[model samples]
Target: MKNKFIYLIYVILSNLPDFYMIRVWFRNITKLRAKVLKLLPNMEISNGVKIYRGVKISRNSNLILSKGVVIKEFCILGGTIAVGEDTQILSYTKIDGSGKVTIGRDTHIGRENDIFSHYHNISDKNILVNKSKECFQEIHIGNNVMLYSRVAVMGGVNIHDNSAIAYGSIVTKNCEQNFIYAGVPAKKIGERI
Candidate 1:
């Protein structure tokens, strides 16, 4: 379609001489970026969604960004990932949705966070780690959740609404609602008011 052609033009122009200059030009042009975002299949992006430069979105994936969602620079969103309204994913965050990742409304995910919806099977000691098949599971982050910097969310974890995860935490289990979780293999530290 016309949008694809425009995106192609943008890609070609961005790869030309003075790459940084062209990236800056594209960064300043929100409309141009939005137009490209609209071309993604199964994307239900609402109004006021801001996807900054250096963000990588997979071509063959379902990405839904609700109203007022902001994905900052260098964020990689792959596979099936749905971000709810008013959610902000800061810079350097990588969301792997090889299974499915559903982030609820009003959520704030800080920088350098790694969220994975799939994991490799390491049950068999005989099998090579790299050759093992990946196990897929859904990761759900409920409404009003706040995940601080450097948090790692593994697969099959359900983080309920109104929860805040502290920095440098590794979430391997379900998080209770309306509480603050911290430390490795994150535990409920205290209740959130």
Candidate 2:
């Protein structure tokens, strides 16, 4: 019983700030500026780093950004989206979760990427507000994985340790440990470095 109480308190405490932050950000979003006002830059955010207002970041103190990691307009990040040394994230990417989102060193991500951990209940609109109707899953990306622009990654998708995904790809399937993939539903075309 005590453990349950502690767990409940911890969960609420962790999400309270992030939840409110996203709310305030969306409420104050302008036509040009993205809302990252809820995020206090602690570690190095680097030059040319752009964050959208609806980002769901964990503690800023625990997050670190290397040089040249650029997030474009309407890009959502707030979980532990730790860019490794000298990695670059191009425009219009979305990352949301409290689960681990570890980007490898020197990985490059292209534009219009949707990365998330939570799934909304689209079947019924009002049921999504019940808090008990939501389901979440974690996604893990490998070191040196290069995902091109306009990639749509659904839940339960994992790219292995060193793979490259081509542009305009819909990743409904996972690629092998070291391969290159492309197309609407991406598939392993060949092995790559």
Candidate 3:
């Protein structure tokens, strides 16, 4: 009940335009917000994990942040998201893990990157208002991966280890390990050196 109350407050705050400024202020004062989040049942934060202000998280969501993870300011990351050790998620990144999003160790998610683990239901013609079942798929981002700015990773995509996704790319499928991908649909451009 307590966790749900906090989640409701966060949901309401997220809708506010000045929420980002409020979060940045919270980051400057202390780690109180982070400490409060530690009380959530599904959240696990190891030592040295830094969550900057203006980051809206869900209490009911399973969010595991390993050691040395730094989530920058103004990031809306929530749901069943597991960020590996030492991974850095830059500002303005939005991760929706309503299904599951697993980001591996030493990964760098650049600014404005959007990651989604679920797609809205709009398939059924009979029920236009209600729609069909939601499409929920997991997103697996492997170790040492680099997702550049403005990257949009769709649901059910697997970004393999040591891969680098170029800026402004849209990933729709599985990316091969140790390669560089770019452009719409994110084709393999070259091998990672």
Candidate 4:
């Protein structure tokens, strides 16, 4: 019951115009919002966490946001997720954590990135992909990783620490540590210096 009320208040506040004048009047709006969000069930948000306006977090989600984590405007987060300290998820990024998503510290997920931890099982040719049973796989993104704009990460992918994925890449396999990857079904391009 308390979570519902908090979520309602969040919904109302998130709809308010994010103009300078409005912010001036509500100087601590972001902080207030974070406080309310922190009260939700199964959510653990540390200090210095900034969740911008227009970000939609599902009520069913189990989220753990560490210190200095910033989720930019219009991002959608759902399911079970744990984001480490100092990580930033840029605008319009969608993290589907139905199968669990663990993003490490100092990571940057660029704009419009789509990270999913669940995929439809399409082994049966008779059934349509959409109608197929869903398979859950955890996505583990190590510390100091960077996923550029428009990157699409499929389920069961482990992005090792200190790696950088180029813009518009589609990652379907595990990425090595300290490497640079690019292209569809992303392949290693070079080592990160």
Candidate 5:
């Protein structure tokens, strides 16, 4: 089928180190090299992983992704994004963090999932121009959790192991083990099968 053919071609293209060498050559010639190098602050990136075009990584962060992790199209991230082996962050999953985000082993975050560690206090009218410094918190997603499509996790939340967060759920608290939670401010629906 045409889809299979396209995938095969993609696999072949991804394997070609010469293509990456050419990319490096082209990148070095451009004015964007400084801007590109400014993105990675502290990170150890392994080879053979696909970093798509237009991906903006942050400058001050610890990002260590193991092999075969495909960070797909237009996915912008910043923070401690330590993806375990074979984890896939699909398209447009904004793993933005001012604090810390530790995604445990073997997790898959679906498209457009905003896992933010913390946010600002814009409501404080007393402070002029919101002059208060960045407020950060920890977001710990346990092992083997599948965050379905469009899931948004707020700051300071801990998700337990073997848990699955359903689509469009806004998680604002701790999710227990082996549970399925889906809703605004996501709650426990039932036990997973």
Candidate 6:
């Protein structure tokens, strides 16, 4: 009952236009918001964590937002996830963390990006893909990564440190460290020096 009430408060606070406007004028409102978020069950929010208005976090989510993490407006985060310090998730991004998803520090994720940790089982040709059992896979993103706008990271992908993903890329495999990837299936285009 306590958890439900807290979640209700969070939902109400997140939707309030006045609260959102006040946050723009008073930066301290971000801290206040973090305090409220910390009250939710299975949530660990550190100092300087900013969760902007219109961001939806599922009730069952086990989330950890490190210090200086900024989640922009209209972002959807669910399941078990941990974001390192100073990571920024831009507007309209969706992180479906049905499995564990860990993002290292100093990472920048551009707007409208989708990071998914779950997929439907497709081994059975007799059954529809949508109707198949869901499979969960962990996604690990190393430090100082940059993901451009509209990128789609599929399940079981490991993006190494200092990597940059170009816009509109679909990541279906592992990304090596210090590399730039782009394309429909996200191939290595260049290496970071």
Question: Which regions of candidate 2 fall more than 4 Å away from where they truly are?
Answer: 1-62, 66-68, 72-74, 121-132
Candidate 5 on 18-55: residue-level lDDT in tens? Answer: 33467675433222322233234366566545565445
Order of the predicted models by TM-score, top scorer first: 4, 6, 1, 3, 5, 2
Clashes of 1: 0
CA lDDT scores, all candidates in order: 0.85, 0.59, 0.84, 0.91, 0.72, 0.91
**Of the candidates numbered 1 and 2, which has the greater TM-score value?**
1
**Residue 67 shift from truth in candidate 2, angstroms:** 5.8
Clashes of 3: 1
Q: After superposition, how far is residue 175 of candidate 1 from its true place, in Å?
A: 0.4
- Model 1, runs deviating above 4 Å: 1-28
Per-residue accuracy of model 3 over 85-149 as CA lDDT, tens digit each: 99999999999999899999999999999999988777666767556677899999999999999
Clashes of 6: 0
Better of 1 and 4 by TM-score: 4
TM-score to native of every candidate shown: 0.87, 0.60, 0.83, 0.94, 0.74, 0.94
Winner of 3 and 6 under TM-score: 6
- Residue pair clashes in candidate 3: 23-54
What is candidate 4's lDDT per residue for 86-153, written digit by digit as tens? 99999999999999999999999999999999988899999988799999999999999999999999
Candidate 3 segments whose C-alpha is farther than 4 A from its true place:
1-31, 121-130
Clashes of 4: 0
Q: Give the range where candidate 3 is weakest over 10 consecutive residues by summed lDDT.
A: 11-20
| lDDT, model 3, position 148 | 98
- Pick the winner on lDDT between candidates 3 and 6: 6
Best-first order by lDDT = 4, 6, 1, 3, 5, 2
Q: Model 5, residue 108: what's the lDDT?
A: 85
